[model samples]
Target: MSTAADAPPALREPRLVPLHALAAGIDFGRYFRWRHERDGDPFLVRFPGFGSVVFTGTPEGARELFRAPAELLQPPLPNPIEPMVGPASLILSRGTKHRQDRALLAPAFHRSRISAYGNVIRTAARAELAGERTGAAWRPGTRIDARAAARAITLRVILAAVFGIEESRRRDEYTTATTEFLNSFGGALFLVPALRRNLYGLSGWQRFTAARDRFDELIDGEIRRRRAHGDNGTDILGLLLDTRYDDGSPITECDLREQLRTLLVAGHETTATALVWALYRLHRDPETLARLRAELDTAGPDPDPLDLVKLPNLDAVCQETLRLHPPVPIVLRRLTGDFELRGIRLRAGDTMGVALPLLHADPAVWPEPRRFRPERFLERRYGPFEFAPYGGGHRRCVGATLADYELRIVLATIIGTVRLRLSPRFARGRMPLTVPHNIATGPHAAITFDVLEP
Candidate 1:
């Protein structure tokens, strides 16, 4: 074996040339596809001023990258998102700090705890879709913005499950604050530092900063109220508050608020986008929709939420939806020590981005990858790295179980209680926006539903 000094420098490795800023800014899924076709797997990516980054879309490479020790690899969170997720968010932290925070926060999302929230998710979904058509008949004067409705369901469910806030002035306050914060993130200014100056009255960054302040204030107030009343309820916030580090010290209020922000931002956005895609795909593919409904119907009236969660067809539909278009199609990591990845040397300072879409859509991994085939999931057992809508390894999404649970419950409730038809004008072939990270996988067309039965 060669010594470290004998190895070739990482700079000499093959690389994918940099794309212009304008090209890189739009449609990341398309960009990923183009890069995959051009450079194949483990291609180098470089952004001006951001330095060299490596992007990989192969299963073997992804597995090796994820399994690397934390001492050698670190999570690479972009600077632009730090203000949104906050400084102490787990996504932005690494090494011992990340492990400690993850440990203290893991119990809230434990399988048992997340399963218990199924009813809450169902109730939220039912309430959101109330008065919508149900049955096989087309009801006139019934149109629903699928994305907005999904957002409402997921936002409400997460608010209750994660924050333990029920319907109240405070809940409304949070909903409004979160909406404002999300709306302000649409502009390019958030990423382009030079152009971040105020424009057309209040700039995007200005609005985002202000929204963050309001959201933080509300979260802080809720934390304080819980502390004052000694309300250690079983919700995530309560669990975080009650948890103590191995040193037996409580999490700081600042850190707790940041964690809450991270959860709220990530927990709701991804689930909502997923629901949107699920609904859109179901309506477009009548055969798949019929199969799912048939599976759900076997459960009968007042079926156990847990049973609904386990329905094979329902599970397959959701899985296919995520696999075809994961809400966040890439996960970022930075090298902490010089390493050789699949025979390519990488320096400590390099960033690595895992291309989830390319990985999922690889024909070798999933035959006819572009086809929306839910049966694929039922027919095969994909390894963790093969079908990673939630990523893999230690840095995998902590909220994965909760999000999965919510998606199933909400989708089941919606399909069981509503007869949905795709809007005639629903444009096909439009690409999802890549600028705003949360809604990246959101459908390009405004998917309106005609509710026909109840």
Candidate 2:
């Protein structure tokens, strides 16, 4: 019940960055660096429409913000994401509801059971690679979009392992609807909140709504069918369908649909993007790629999938990829009450976030933070807050275990089998997320790779 008026004047932030710096084509790192250097840690950045936003990268501040009581602080998802996913999503849920939903959903993503899906991940990767264009089939200057290939593999895994939908027709319909729903993200309109309104039947919001409608209908039908027949398998969907509250009552349909969509969206796009960057970076650096293949070759022609994931160097590569280019660069939280962070007072409705990229680039924390050195991970382990590609604390990504398992397995499978090299001519925007060719941005990396041999 405390208000901003109770905060001492000594804790007020001393500087603010103009909102225009966040416009398209701006370098997010440079912008953060500019403000951080001038104002020090826990500085404020003002966006005209969004109001005062506190940005922090130091460990102390990050820990305070991330560990703050749920009643005092809450995750701040953008308006754009809410429309894309749904209002009742666990990602948007807060307080007791958030904790309950997380607990109910925890059984499905348990690490022990997820390892059983390694074959599913491997199978999906191999199938996608089998259909991919290889050196033997390439024309004069053909390059395969690694992002698309990665997306296909990850999407298939989600549909099978998570949804548990073995029916071909229903699966295909669901896939089509899901793809359309994801496509609705990005674009200039996504940033301009006012432009979200439907006008003359032409609007990003309208397109998103249509896609959501299609996806909702397909997923709802699948849910109803599963309910009538009962959950016969151990997929995430089946577990969710059977989840009950402490009162022994079943979860509502609306909550179930939102949770499924949350898993699908979070489970696919970010992991797929990280996969692309891993492949791209390895290919871009031939020595690293050679070393990785050598490590795989160490296990002979046919290594156990479990053994493949355990390879130290391969694990290092995935770790480095995530450290330098985390899919979700920022973890946002909004203050619900007056909060004191590193001697700075943040009022209710003020946004506070840990800028992952900047923290990863901190020299004091990571020596040569800009370099892509996989060995750093092998040398020493980073604390949860120090190397959190998947945001930390209670709200840490629910799919973290599954995602890491998939990334390592997928990388091991693809690199172990296919001979890959970076394409000579590279272009951006191939993927919806605009990760730079040299580094990661947002979720997707838009680099292409040539499949030298199968």
Candidate 3:
């Protein structure tokens, strides 16, 4: 077992590249070989123009590095996100504050609590499908707004999970506003932080980036409403308001808002994208699609969401999807102190990025790495960090179980009842932003389905 006594001495590796010229447009993954070829040092890439150190190693290395997550601070977040996503975000905070913030948020997603959200999740899913059936949303002549479909379903689940009874009243209102706000960003904001100022300012792409002042107004209002009551309610906001430490100090409003905001953005976007991608995949492989449908048929009418954990095929599919298109594919960990990584010495404040998309596709670890096969995940278990789509160690995602729960329930609901397929053209060259680009892209999953009753 690794202990604190371990000293971070200088390390040299078989392949170490020094920071150099060929780092721009780096593929990110396969950086091990690339880095070795370039002399095994850190380098920069130009898509958004950032620096990174690549780590390709065992579970042991991963465990040690992440053991003290606080020690691994990351470079400053790209612009716009820094302010737009909120400064105190669990994803942005450092050291003890990071640990404390994550601690406050963890209980809401603990195993038992996550399981409780399943039934409600299923209910919300059915509502999405109900709307899809009445119109030719994705039929030959009509095109459904897929992201909108995903946003609608996920937002409801989040509201119910976070607000409980409050969801019954304001779900529709929050759905329109929140989805509109998030959908406004899509692929644009992430790829270009500089454009953020242009996009959010007055008359700029409807100029939401400058609308922070307005966002705070709404968020603060929600917090106040939740606090008026207490944790005796079911919403996570309620629980957060009521939660306290042994010292009897409750979390601050700023911290609470950041956590909630993080959940709001990440919680929906990540899961929704994954599921849409999975559906797109299902539409591509008839054999896999047939098998998935067969499995769901066996689950009977109104299947129990928790029961999905036992379905190996379903589990494998989800695993493969995550591996291929992990919602947050790139991880940024700053070397807070001079330390050794995979036998390479690093300086403090230097950042190492784990390109999970590349890692999952690396032929070294995944045989037939490019092929989409869920069985690889079932063949054996990998360490938590080794197979992390939700990250690893102490800073692992608090909502992992909830995310899995939501993905399975929503997927089972649709796959069990609907018949859908993908369009012919968009299937080719559809780049996966998330890892594990499935057989279909989310936008191409514009295919329609006819719901069948069990």
Candidate 4:
């Protein structure tokens, strides 16, 4: 067994390798697979700006990483998403603070709360299908960008269900601000830190900061309004407002802003990307699509969103899509003490992460790993370590429940309502490489579908 004294060798010229490995548009899954083949498990990889990281894709490695003592792990610093999610986000917090915040925020996403949002999810999806965005009804022969449509639906759903923003004018304001803020920080800004400079207000960094300020102003105004009016509504924000720390103090304004930003940014984009992938995969395989549609039909035309969530095939399809294209492909943690993963031992400050693409595609666990097969999920149950699309353990995504509920509900709503096929341009073309989009990764080009009938 390898010990700290016999740590796995680092990839040759770690600096040069990561340039290709982390390149903006490269196929990351292919790169990771190639690396795994060459180096085997528990190999060391180092990104240019980030320090050495030991990555493993085996289920055993994931088990060790996820079960590690919470106090011994923290998000690796100089993280690219820090600027977007903010310093106080649950993603960035560690130790006792993280536990307290998570406990306070967990209830807002409880099954009951999420079940209530089913109607909101369905309403947003149906509105998108009806051409509410462009005001021209979608008709036969109309080609639409699946990602864009899914984004519109997800953004609306998150704002309505999570933030409880029902006023039309305020919703539109948030839509524009959030879209602008996210767009301002392109892949270049995320991948290459040097490109984040503000060159006389012309740089990507400058644009992102400006957009963030506008979005923050809106959030702050809403928070202040709620505080001033003592309006304790039932959405996430209200839950946070009602929460108190063990010390009996309310959450500070800064923490509230960051947490809300985290939910807003992390909540919608990842789910939207997953929805697009689901649509693309479903259309690409007629057999899978037929099966899913058959399952949806069993519940009838006007099935409750919650009922759609319970459909076995629908749940399997969603799980399969997440396995194929996890929105956040890697989960990283910096060590606070000595630890070993898959026999590779490491000391304090050493970093390690679970590479989801490799884990999800392990041939031993998933026969025909590259193939799209939802039946595998229905055939047998997978333990959390074996198949965790939202990551795992204590720090697993706080909004995971809401995201899963939304994905199932929204996907069912669309598949049941629309009769569509992949646009010819993308019908037989090779799958586009997934690229970084602000915080999440998605298909390089828009996945468009031709509306056959509705």
Comparing 1 with 3 on lDDT, the higher-scoring candidate is 1
Best by lDDT: 4
1 against 2, candidate with superior lDDT: 1
Provide the lDDT at 66 for model 2.
75
Reference-based lDDT, each prediction: 0.77, 0.73, 0.61, 0.85
What is the per-residue lDDT of model 4 for residues 366-412, given as tens digits with 9 covering 90 to 100?
99999999999999999888898999988898788788989999999
Residues 260-352 of candidate 2: C-alpha lDDT, one tens digit per residue: 887887788788888988887786677888889889889888666777778999999999999877877767777788887787766787677
Model 4, C-alpha of 7: deviation from truth (Å): 7.4
TM-score of 4: 0.96
Each prediction's number of clashing residue pairs: 4, 0, 13, 0
User: Which stretches of candidate 2 lie above 4 Å from their native place?
Assistant: 1-21, 132-142, 166-168, 427-445
Structure candidate 2, residue pairs in collision = none
Model 3 TM-score (2 dp)? 0.81
Cα lDDT, model 1, residue 315: 95
**Candidate 1 weakest ten by summed lDDT:** 1-10
Of 2 and 4, which scores higher on TM-score?
Answer: 4
Candidate 3 local lDDT, residue 147 = 53
